[model samples]
Target: MFDAQYSENVSHPLRVVPLSQLARAGGLGLGAERSYMAPVLFWIAHGQGRLSVGGALRGYTGHNAIFLPANLSHGIEISPRCQGTAVFFAEKSMLPFPPTELHLRMQGVQVQSEMNQLIEELRLESLSDSPDRDLMLFHRAALMLLWLNRQSGKPHVPSVQVSDMLRAIAQPKR
Candidate 1:
């Protein structure tokens, strides 16, 4: 059986994995309607696919990000050309991530670039051995969630400069 409080208190807390890896093991049973204990976000870097969430089927193309809340049954059918990253967030994570499902089709080149950069940073953080790796991961994940919120028409907030964010995360957590 799975850990009872795993979603609430995962050791590592967050993960960033390539979509291919997610699709490798029978798509992690994603093809069949299922729910995760924690929330998951998928950033589609390329290609097209259809996602079924809460019994609603929707088609998505490249430059898209999909966020699904925990315990919300869903399934995905990604095309062979689809490319993306799957971001999993711990249930008890304090980040201000979207509380509902979001399917954002990023339109502008700048927006797409920002999303790409954010995902890359998350990927690097996930692979790093920094003493504050988990902390850094949470920080980057928060920025990404912010980006998604912005694209989804949430209230506008001052954007954090990359240099400032990097410097902040570099500081050792006390």
Candidate 2:
């Protein structure tokens, strides 16, 4: 099921929300078919569900990461017990996200923990009011892109390395 609603605000470069919140919102904002002007990433840490992307239906379970590119129709049916986070990225950002969709079944505890940490960092950066909050968010978001690209086996140009260098330089010396 998909919703025809298309009024999502893209002013925020990124957003992270629990899957339960979306499920509670109904219209299958958790299940209904919907499309956004920006890309979306779904990280399923627990439970199982059905997802439809670009008109193809597939089943997804825990430790899964799904990426849907902008303007493509998608909808998900996550179980009540599903524990997950949805990451939305503004279409206007300069981040180097892959042009195609990805449904990654992440394996290994190390890789899973790495993805979780990166998301936690993004969530924290988003709540800060620091003068360089935007820059920090961009850097963190770029790291996420780098992680995704690497995990997906896609060739990447390493822009996040520059962000890492900038962060090192910004840190106060011990």
Could you say which candidate leads in lDDT?
A: 2
State the lDDT of candidate 2 residue by residue for 69-102, as single tens digits.
Answer: 8778877896679998888886689887887899
Report backbone clashes per prediction. Answer: 0, 6
Report the error of model 1 at residue 40, Å.
Answer: 0.6
What digit string (tens of lDDT, one per residue) describes model 1 on residues 25-126?
Answer: 554434677777778888998988788888887898999899988778888876656798888887677777786899998989999999999999998988
TM-score per model over all chains: 0.80, 0.83
Which segments of model 2 are wrong by more than 4 Å? 1-4, 7-10, 29-31, 158-174
RMSD of each: 6.2, 4.8
Clashing pairs in 1: none
Q: lDDT scores for all predictions?
A: 0.79, 0.81
Worst 10 residues of 1 by lDDT: 1-10
Candidate closest to the true structure, highest TM-score: 2
